[model samples]
Target: MNKSPGFILTQLGLDKDKVEKLVKALDPKTLQIAITDDFGSSFVLSTLSANIASIVETNVVLQHEKDGDLGNGWLETNYAGSRAFVLRSWKPNESDVLEANLTFWRGAPSIKRVVIRHVPEPATQRLLLEKGDVDMARNLSADQIAGLAGNKDTVVESSPKAEVYYDGLNQKHERLRNPKVRQALRWLVDYQGTTESFLEGRFKVHQAFWPSGFAGSSTETPFRLDVAKAKALLAEASYPNGFEVSLDASNFYPSIDVAQSVQATMAQSGIEVNIVPGEQKQVITKYRVRNHPMVFLYRSADYLDPHSNADTFTRNPDNSDKAKSRPLAWRNGREIPQFTEKTDAAARERDPAKRLQMYLELQKIVQENSPFVIVFQVQDQPARRANVKGFVTGPFADQIFYLLVQKRGSRDRGLAQPGSPILAGPDPGIRAVACDAPRASDPRHPRAHFLRAARGRLRDRPGGTDRPRPRDRG
Candidate 1:
């Protein structure tokens, strides 16, 4: 039950030397310090604070309070972009936070500059790639990626069960409170159709609160499309007019295809769903704050631990901004506890069969009373570039938090093999290498030298002389 805090990080390619060097450079007492500027400090510390906020609710005392700040939050950001973000730190006294944010504009070459354009639709993204407009655009249906894969320029990488896509059953609704309604909705999803039509045969419907590999995950496919059974369940529950509910996620991951599909598919089960499509912010407001929507779609985590993301339904049931559930109106009288106590028992509970038993029970309870319906686990994108070298993938590839090494092409600096010494920084002579290639000293970091070359840390693409496509990326 002893797990390393950075197991995921190392597994994602920040292994050993690179991780050690980066941590040494980033840590205060360590020799190599990346930046000391206010903006950089803000960016780094703020991210840390946000992470802290997510994991453990603790006091985050930061250093400065920059009032009226504005900046752009993008895939690869810089000092200029910091101008676009308005930051509110967890604490107004931590200097490290400032250093991390402004790491972009320190006049040093960065590790990489990833371009993220909100394609929002798979077909358009495919079209853009076919036209050479994007280096990478996400949320494509599995089929779209398959079609794109036929082309040399585009590639698709996804997770088997990276995240769960599910329908939510509001705890407040009277009939929904009954386990029958929630369990019935599970039987209504066309998992095969989704795999064929949306995912393009790239995904499978997953049951259990967690996916197959996690500590408490199960490989059982409990729910399948059975409209007849669903109908019978509804009839037993009484009134087949089907409950009126609003489907919150009306937009698509890559396109409106997924949302529209959900809308049409759910209607097949006789549920009267009012399709509502709007800005995600507005929809989130309605779901979390206003409590106006009965069903909100959620795709949550299944990594590090199964209990990691399960608390959202168990705790954040109330839309109240103060982060507390309202008093219960049930026969039990008292309000249900927002958060079940998480302990060593919960995190490292050893018995797989026994733990899975507990997890199954939780799944049943959640389905019966929560506002989440677990759907098929999804695939995610990884760090892929044209001719880029020295990059590795990790379990967290589905989660972007690790280092990706990039080197200019062979002529850029006569690149060495992985684990080889960095002899002279990036220039036209550097050779680019990929993670899939033989061992080469990773150029995107502070490598020990023959002359010890310094890459942009993430700056230049692999072969710089012939720039790939300088097209205005979205």
Candidate 2:
């Protein structure tokens, strides 16, 4: 089975026979895999590592289950996984309902039901959140976020997303092909000014491809708005008069604003920039084909690994238009052989500390030289009613989990009162079992007591009381 051409061994560039011999099924619940190559650690962090790591949920079906392009309809008709919630109903462009998974392995979710409504208008979303008709409002503009400041009933939660916004200078353009010109464009970006104004609270100045808060991320901001320096570099690149170029940007907030800012700054150094704004899809379609001279865009990592961003931003194995592997570097027509070699080596490094150091060095090299001018990392700000608690939004939007989320009031009142059940529903029988299990102060809380006992801090006395055990002073 491992030797079959359809197997993933070919994709990983591994010897199928070796891998097959190293993997064995010991029992129904136990499978062992031995890694013989340095690529093992990095591969484990990727989405292709395991079924659970895949972006799509892993489902158990008959040997020969559904076939032929299911496309987007797969999730609509099928149910899978042992998640806290199960899809109850879905209506295209309208709303979706998620019912609590009563038989979930962990426990039934606190919320009995979750209804997600599609309200595209930010104003409408704000109104619904303020009126207590909705528990949370996800898509809101900078102005809308500020407007909700005085709403005591609603509180905004902010989290730093792993998405980074940047300007990709296409090497296909003759003028942009110069390394000095590319470096000069970096200085033209007013990172401080942009983040301070329209992009305030929404984005932070992040110069590196790998976003901050990651293990090997670099928070270095070397380039600023230096017009004289940019002009000198343009002169060195044999473009003393500064050449004219077209920039493709999405006709929406932030992208258009950033493009206009770039345009204004580039003009200071005698560069003429013509802004061509189009719909998001149209702009991205052009960008993907390397048809744009320059593009203003944002990218989020596919997985939580330093190699994720490094591979996309630095490694371009093939610069040809027909290249099978097209990452961000390929799309920008950048042929970075040195960066590619370093990125691959970093991914394969066995030691955690050494791998992290390699990534930090790679980020510095890309930050100073690459055609991509990484500007800001996005901050997701979602407003929710005060009654809603334990709502978690991870670095990625898809990482949002509602397992522990709870409403602290009666269903009809929409107001939280002290001593109310964590979640309220019409059927009191379906109340959260975990909530009624134990209090933190109760001696019977097994988890708390076990944790303390594990640290040798707590011991049971003869009278059934927990007392702190004496430390071993010796």
Candidate 3:
């Protein structure tokens, strides 16, 4: 809705010239559509109309039919109470036919038809939409969102992902391990200006350590940006000069705001900084070593966890007990956190305030020693099809399954049974099951910002991130 109709025709994927040529074949007004996400395809899709056509959720093509251009799509199956859905794309095999996928929130996905696609990039996603393979995609960057300004027929919603973007501290370094240094870094960041300029007012600058709805996250006081205070902290740390560090980058992900701001602010104290942008995997490998030191990163929350977050970076990696069946982030081959070994006794305290206090104390200790610097806790955001309504945003800032989004022709596509499904975009009786899908591996994964000397442990996990990991604040 933020975009207009005339803009739809200019999109390259629509084959604008051909669409105009076939203007007589379709109703100009009925082809309208709307949706949101910060993915790359959104840039081009934003140019489409929303009057008659629209996309509800994100789609990724797994296997394709060479002859028909129809391929099998995927969704979260481990999620219980989720509806069955599929996007027609590549038909790699006959088995793909009659394949169905469930969208519940938790459990292992027992997919019958849909394939799970972990590394979804914009280029391939854009190609799928332009070819009429899917009606919609999710998430686009500020630049990508602006590019869709010309597309009139499609509705584009550039919702920021429910996560915080901040510079994490490296706990391993004795000097930076100091809270003064971490506090100074926080003061140096121009949170509001940078987020607004980069995310176009879609992102939230969290004032609290934990985002809303998490166990330990609280809405207490806020952290303001203050360069003057930052200078004082540097002086207190005896670092008239800033520390020297190599901001290993994945060429695609590492945000310019993070690198440039960090570089400039530290320079004020005489600390020199270097930047090394390369393939994500190699850079991540180089970064985790005790010898390879990185100071901070721009990050947002990946999941809702107050206690287990440090398990990845601080927990002794060799420890056998695991929250996730596989080796987690920050833990790959290294040692696990000391806290993970000790169970939280607060849960048995039975006193609400006492438990809250205990968790707060634990969080404080983690903050004191951990290399991760949490900026703000964010909220979850999930989008759906306009026609396939009955969707609602939640207090929690992450994706949830189980709610039904009824598409206009989904019955034909074998989604709903028809005869008036949920079409209103509000939380409708949908139950949320927490899906603990393992974080799929990507070679370009930005884990290097946290765990080094542990990359080899990840070899058992096979995967790589999309081209640049546009959101790799780490």
lDDT of each: 0.43, 0.71, 0.39
RMSD of 2: 12.7
| lDDT of each residue in 388-458, candidate 2, tens digit only | 88878677645667789888754421121111111111111112122122332345333344445445543
lDDT of 1 by residue, 95-197 (tens): 1011112122333232323233333345775676566444444445566666665576544555454356666555556766666776677777777787777
Best by lDDT: 2
Q: Which stretches of candidate 2 lie over 4 Å from their true place?
A: 1-37, 40-43, 46-73, 412-474
Global CA lDDT computed for model 1:
0.43
In order of appearance, the predictions have TM-scores of 0.56, 0.78, 0.50
Every model's Cα RMSD, please?
A: 13.4, 12.7, 21.3
Candidate 3 lands at a TM-score of: 0.50
Model 1 spans > 4 angstroms off? 1-143, 152-155, 160-162, 201-204, 241-243, 252-259, 315-361, 367-371, 382-474
> By TM-score, how accurate is candidate 2?
0.78
